[model samples]
Target: MLSSINNIFGNSKKKKTDAIQSAVVAYSIRNGKLTVLNEVPEQSVKNVQAETNGLVLTQGFHKIGGSFFYFEEPGLYFFSFPFQKNSLRIVVGKDAIENALLISNTIIRGNKDDEQSLKHLKKEVLDRFLVLTCTYACIFVQHILNETGIKSRLVMTLTAEEENQYNDGHTLLEVYDTAIKKYVLVDIDKKCVFESDNGEKMDLLSFTGAIKNEAKIRIVSAAGFPKLDWAGFCAVDSGFNFQFIEQMFCYDEQQQLNLYKRICNLPVIMADNKYFSVSSATEVKNSWKNKLNFLPVEEFRQKFYPL
Candidate 1:
């Protein structure tokens, strides 16, 4: 047991080197004003002061960090700056993005886990850590993808909880994989993507469907993390006919694998443009108690887009 934990630690990502790479700075409007998070602070803003080409920043801009000027505004915004060191020749296609997950892989993983209280770090996780908690890695990678013009959403996978156990719900990303022509789930914290035995990538709903139909599915490495190291960490249904999927991205000798396995009827909410914002955090959603509104996805789409 100790050896497995030590092995995972030994296989974790190495620290960063002093090479200049691209930059990603995130902002949210706090107290009716634009404010940059200190964890992903003003200093991380490299060279995005002005508009690039004709992109206009679409929504209103603000000077949260010291990197930009004349951009005073209020309220939260959900937009990502198209990041590139120089002129970015926009790729044209029905799928206008590629290599998003791979590009993010080079930037988001980190060895450090002090994400919440990382107020004092100069620059936190501009690149690499497989050991960071699921939520932290998801949020950072979401921003990086959005910054680079890839569409992604936050997905919370819930499972049945035991009386005294914590680690039931987990957060990961639902990224639009162009090759699949649909969204697929990617677990950056685990350095893996969920897939079926036939080599098709899977989103949460699809994964649940495969499990329901008694099909073979598995997790494959996104980076160089070996498949053998990550095998057998997940136990679906927990030896019953229930629709539960409990996976352990973290190394635990005690076998607390209930991280991000999926099941129907869990009914997770808050997947939208603001999915990455703090205002849409999972804990905040739990505070609504029973008054939260519910809607059918198909019906909701038909009513909203009745064209």
Candidate 2:
């Protein structure tokens, strides 16, 4: 996986050395009142005071770190003088966006075991962590495809009732491969593509079903995180079986292989050898659990426990 990821980015040219630089100042309106976050003294606004709520201009660029633009409706606005000389204008083109996303992935790369931080978190907070994990995964996968020079965007699984009644949805990455001139539907977590979706039996397998189901699905902006109540991750019956236990109970590759082998040797019944007995399921589960250093729900407490 690491080698494959390297091969993807290695193909792309390094970002340009001539980095654009500027300073930004923004004012937002919430609840019909203009407000500035910084507690600037009233006298500081003498030079740039806006007599009305039209637009404001600044004098020159100032030192600002990690340049980016962000705005939201009913609360935030990316305010700057459009025509003024030396004023901040967000220059986030496609290449810039791609670079930012790649940088984020690099930060998250060495921290796969970082789930330890969730230890002792309340169930409310743990739920939030799961939402964040999936959301970040969606963004990471989309950016990874973009960095590889493949055209892709995020998709949401929504039912007719969901569309009619609710405003929630699940995130999925859909990519367009120029070489094949076809679209590929991908679920990054399962690491598979859509094999079939008949509203009853949805198959998420790799490589096969994408070619037959090539259609121009409407894409939406990838902004906010997805919710747990969303269709894909909501219920096991929804056909997107999220393996929460598998993710929470992580194992290294060798440990996983060893567990598989051990379970195979047991007297557990098997369904075509792909399934195991539920009667001894507790024993099998506990065996793997013993290998981990700490419990999932009480990892922090484990540290203080007596030997």
Candidate 3:
């Protein structure tokens, strides 16, 4: 299903247009009514050539580069691939993310700390009355970027004190910046970044390696959080609150950060009919591990929980 969606939304020669719509990728196609993926805007798609099996076509179906068309016939058909990269630069990504965060701020209201809270968090998201949880924040952003062919994921942050019960736990996102061919960690909701000593924006794995080495990291934030509805969700709403975070982390004697969770694409964050396609947990975890390239000190021999 993912592959088929990717192919249909795949990039190819598109006709030039004076204006581009902030529409998302195709979501569901039941009874010939195409539902666009939620919020994940495809602003770059100027035109698309739709067909069936490279041969058959329905009446009013687009045969060439057409921005607007009609699907008059009804039946189930396959789609193309997903995650075809978009070439728009610098500000486009930031603007898209900020816009997404603003929307998330208004909807989801609170942060869901661990598995226990997720039970209720899931219900809140489906209802459109959002709670300010990092998990769902990433879910929203991941799909927004995913629909437009930008790669991203939902990752967890766990504390080394395994018995702490996730008091220090957090969740963040790792977005693949195709321009650099590297994944960068995003504070997601607040539009901030994790950086190393050299002032480079760090990916989750790289930051994990730095944390392993007892190195310091800088959390650079943008201006501020927009005035939104769910201002009460402190944990998520304080994304740019570096002082708050630093004060919280000041107690850590050895490490500046807690153990980072191996990438879990959030296989469980499902929606009946919205945006983002969930992938297998094993698949996302392995992909994250493979990206590690050079292995860190594997102290957790039995199970590699952290780097």
Candidate 4:
């Protein structure tokens, strides 16, 4: 999301740069008064409308930040002014036209203290402003593509090292790929095998028997894993199924072959074969609890006081 926002606003080519740099402003009005607004310099004022009352007012952009007054109705009036030299604008209206003018003058021509007050007012306007403009381009696109929909699914493969090194700072694609390849094979609406990083490999039947007999398996790593390094199988049911395979091979061909053989001998149950790479088991467990939003008290006890 951050990357997408940056991409839309960060390009530096002359044409795209000009388009982004072009000012975008916002505004809103309520209860027969203008309340929230933004003022921009260089670019044109694209559109304006009232959100609550359905009253509409339209105007063009001015190069300088200044004041403009107009009458809307009998005993009612509108006033527009810029907040800063090149920032947003604030529009205010009132039934008492004379009082409104006095306040507007005090704000626009007042002393340094008054200027400070106006700056605060401008900040408030900016903080609360909402977009009142609607473009026909978006409407047209929505209308044309109303019937079509997009669906996608990903099956990732990650390594043990990658699993234990989890960080949201990485791209979604990177994380997805890492999770699928290392721990579980994700598929749509189908039961798939889950692999664990247990010290020794065993067949599925033996693995299930051991897990059923022991009830719990201990995850131990003498070489500490990175913070947030954990792995799990997540199955998403969203009406789409796609499959892709990724293989990892190293320069040491003999070592790679031996590793492959070991993996091939592993158990098949989703729970029995799972392993997490984490710097501290307790911390990782707590983090997962907070993220997943529900931790059984029994699980909590096991996390803090594991036998």
Best model number under TM-score: 1
The sequence of per-residue lDDT tens digits that candidate 1 reaches over residues 96-145 is 12233443343233323434433322133222123344576677667656
Q: What does the lDDT read for residue 119 in candidate 3?
A: 44
Model 3 lDDT per residue over 1-307, tens place: 9987776555321321211332323332332254442321245333444443222233343422223333333322222222331210111233333333333332332443323343454443332344455666676656545555666666554333323322444567766665666667776544457788888878655565565466777755442433223334344444533334334433342222342322221211112322222222233333222222222234221122222
Poorest 10 consecutive residues by lDDT, candidate 3: 84-93
1 or 2, greater by TM-score: 1
TM-score of each: 0.44, 0.24, 0.40, 0.16
- What residue runs in model 2 are displaced by over 4 Å at the alpha carbon? 1-132, 159-168, 196-307
Sort by TM-score, top down from the best: 1, 3, 2, 4
Q: With candidate 4 superimposed using the best TM-score fit, by how many Å does residue 248's alpha carbon deviate from the native?
A: 55
Better of 1 and 2 by lDDT: 1
Candidate 4 residue lDDT tens string, 131-242: 1101111121122122122111221111212122221111000001221232112111110122344543222232333333443322221112111101211113442211
For candidate 2, give the lDDT of residue 247: 38
lDDT for residue 97 in candidate 3, whole number 0-100? 36
55-137, model 2: which lDDT tens digit per residue?
11122221222222222222323334223222211112233222223222222211122343323222222112223343456
Ten contiguous residues with the weakest lDDT in model 2: 200-209
Query: What is the RMSD, in Å, between candidate 1 and the native fold over all Cα?
Result: 15.9
The residue ranges of model 1 lying beyond 4 angstroms of the native Cα positions read 1-122, 126-131, 212-214, 226-307
